[model samples]
Target: MVSKNQIKRITGLHQKKFRNEQQLFIAEGIKVIQELYNSSFEIQEFYSTDSSLQLNNKVKPDIISETDLKKISCLKTPNTCLAVFKIAPSKPIKYEGLTLVLDDIRDPGNLGTIIRLCDWFGIEQLICSEETADLYNPKVIQATMGSIARVNVVYTSLERFLKNTKQPIYGAFMDGDVVYETELPTTAVLVMGNEANGVTATVEALIQKKISIPRFGKLQKTESLNVATATAILLSEFRKNLSGK
Candidate 1:
């Protein structure tokens, strides 16, 4: 049985301060919780209708009332499971392959989708601006599907990380050299910016080179692509070049 106080604490994680104070965050949906349970991340608690708990012996999941599950869950509709996981500390960044650095991407869906894209492209490391949405925000976690386990998302100062990187840096820009034409570097920092605003002056100043995606659609109305979609295209090109595609 999930107590009222316990529900209060779990729901409080919706706010950043609470999440930090407790060192835990909520993960909804059966699949998302299942993935976390299987990862190195420690699962503090989980709730499911079934009392058997046969999936993982380590997980001593508690049974909770449907109403209690709904109260603590972030989703509009309560999923089959909700898990409380200890927030993982930032890991040592091993920047060997094509890395993506995001500049203040505010949207949770965009960040989550980007994480999924990273998983698909086999890009292991992602560096985000300090102001970017929290990777463990329930929305971002859910949107990632199951890729959260694979991608190492580090939230730090984009400028500092870019400045220190030994590899070349490529910033995505609207008014820049065509991505397809540019001689793509094997290993580098690919900077993608916010949905509404592009890279800020501070981050922009650190960029050593700029590249852009050419739009082929009939409508001249589409001036720029969404940051996440643009990210997919750019990474696609870089990966293809790496594979001799």
Candidate 2:
């Protein structure tokens, strides 16, 4: 059983401010917890209703009741287990073959899907504008489906980073030339903008190439593609070129 203070502290991690203050975040479900356990993230605490669950970490989990787990869980239907892990220190951004730059992507699901896409396509780094969804947001972690453990995600100033990098920058836009027709470089920065507004003017100025996913529907009334789905198609296109297809 967990003490009232402990429950309060663990629940606090659901908020970004508290997560930052505690330098800790929560991962729920067996898969997410297992992935974090296998990764470099240091597990600070583990709480589970199942007493037999095995963990490789040196810290033995507090075997709590399902009632106790619910007190600290943010999920509507709490999973069987939840683990708290210390946030790993950010590594220096590696300017490599292809980097993903997100300009204020505010949706947690979109950010999580993008991270998974980066991992699938072998993109080494992901750069997000400071306003982008928190990397540790519970919904984002759940959406990543363990891909969060592999991808390197960082938040920084979009303008400053763009100004400093010499790599060719590409931005996805509704009016730009069809993506299938664009001459994509193997090594460059791909910028994905916010869901509703697309790219901001400041960041757009830094984009060397403007590209778009062509719509084939006769009505052509679809306002735009969901950012995550667009990311999947764009990354697939980028990987094809990298593989010399």
Clashing pairs in 2: none
The per-residue C-alpha lDDT of model 2 at residue 234 equals 87
CA lDDT, every prediction?
Answer: 0.86, 0.89
Deviation (Å) of 69 in candidate 2: 0.8
Candidate 1 lDDT: 0.86
Worst 10 residues of 2 by lDDT: 52-61
| Model 1 bad stretches (over 4 Å) | 52-54, 57-60
lDDT of 2 by residue, 1-245 (tens): 78999999999999999999989999998778888888888888889898767676444567998889999998999998899999887778887789999999999988988998998999879999999999999999899887887888888999998998989999899988899988888889999999999999999999999899999999999999999999899888878965755
Can you give the lDDT of residue 92 in candidate 2?
85
Q: To one decimal, what is the Cα RMSD in angstroms of model 2 from the true structure?
A: 1.4
